[model samples]
Target: MSTGPLNPETSTSLPSPPFVHLKGIPNFRDLGGYKVAGSDLIVRRGYAFRCGEPTSATPEAIETIRGLGINHIFDLRSLPEIQKMQVAGTGPKTVDWPGVTRVFTPVFREESYDPVSLAKRHADYQSEGSEGMVNAYRTILTEGANSYSIILRHILEDARRSKNTAETALIFHCTAGKDRTGVLGALLLSLCGVPDEVVAEEYNLTEAGLGEWTELLVQAVLKQGAASEEGARRMVGARKDSMINTLAMLRDEFGGPENYIVTKCGLTEAEVAEIRHFLVVGE
Candidate 1:
């Protein structure tokens, strides 16, 4: 994996496919193709992607993505997330790409609100919807465990694609690809038998990988009249506490990661067995 901006010509030589970059889309890269769990085979290159709000994708950007043979698009943004961060352009609103599958994974919906906004704007989720936000958070406590199921669905689709020679790649994302996407990444890596430290390291990479961008985000926000350190802090982070908390939540609900998948995520042991059989590179 070349850890740099992918130039169209030089990218062909990359260990994994060159990262698919668009001027407007941030963090669009393959999560597969990394050395993990002692397997020579990694997640198939060009199969999985993590990106920020893609509403800004230009015609060229969409063309590049289409060229990558994306079979499915798993959108992790909440309804409000999409609305708030409206991509610059609009297209035929269809999840079904000509040869792809589209899935919407919303942790929070448009109606939900979190009073705490970034320090810069001093904005709150209040305008979005007060009770909806509270209800959404409560639902997370009670049903947050359900995300595992949604994730499993996407992976199963990936596994199925791998089995069939059809486009066997899937890309998933949330707004920043840090929290929602981060947890899903953690779950998948852990299931592949990657160590917690490795997972943590991968999670932490967000700060380094996105640090410059985070700074730019702060500057952009300030240019928009947001002047708060909290906003800046929020931009440059893989919040340790949030990561730890999510892990704790998983442990508390499911005896282990596997249990979380089978019991909580709606995957039977056999189903998970199928996923492992197809998706994992090595035993």
Candidate 2:
């Protein structure tokens, strides 16, 4: 239950696991307990969470989420991904989090479902280990800035309205609760002064968070002779190095996450500070 600074870089810590293994909701977990760099502060638990599509969450799970004091549930899946898919996990989300407001926030704009492009991306994953995760991270932060900003602003505003960040906990997710969700998670952690490497490790935890869906995703990622089992696994899995490279890109290109959110996402300095303050606790 306790997770503090493991080191300045490299967040390989397991004093306790952080995932919430709710039935039917893969990768559902708390996004807290991270230690902030150069301080004794740790990110507050029960304040933020991440998960995959929750359409399959059981009623009991919905009740659990409701009791978590969640003020908003941000759905970051693209419209097509959320509304058009026929698959069980990838399809439109139908389960609601009790009475919590579900904000349909698509972090990606609609685009033609180009099979060739997706195949090429998978090929890139096989040929290249990181599968161009840096670019993907960058695209979501930049091109998807508006949607991300909305999520951030809403969290801050809701906290103001409720006058309690803990009661205003926000849960956000994409299809697998990794890629797009991972990027936003990293940003928030980094804003709380988490080291870049540790942030990457947080992003990397998605592999385990995906739980049994790992095989399903690997199978779905595999396309006729496109990649070996290992390669397809790599495509479906969240690599720490990919997230590390993404963190480096954020530092080298965007001057770390704080500046990126301010310059690109258009959040005011006070708003960003308030979010950081709420996230990190203990002096």
* Winning model by lDDT: 2
TM-score of predicted model 1?
Answer: 0.69
- Give Cα distance to truth, residue 267, candidate 1, Å: 1.3
Q: What are the lDDT figures for the candidates, one per model?
A: 0.53, 0.69
Q: Pick out the ten consecutive residues of candidate 2 with the lowest summed lDDT.
A: 1-10
Candidate 1 deviant stretches above 4 angstroms:
1-19, 38-41, 86-98, 110-148, 164-166, 208-213, 216-236, 239-249
Range of the 10 consecutive residues with the lowest summed lDDT in candidate 1: 1-10
Cα lDDT tens digits for candidate 1, 94-212: 23446666777565554322111232223431222233222322344344456547767767866775673435666776655555667777777666666566666666655544434
lDDT by residue for model 2 (141-232), tens:
77667878988888677557655346567788876777788888988898888887788788877777665566665665554344677776
Candidate RMSDs in Å, in order, are: 7.5, 7.2
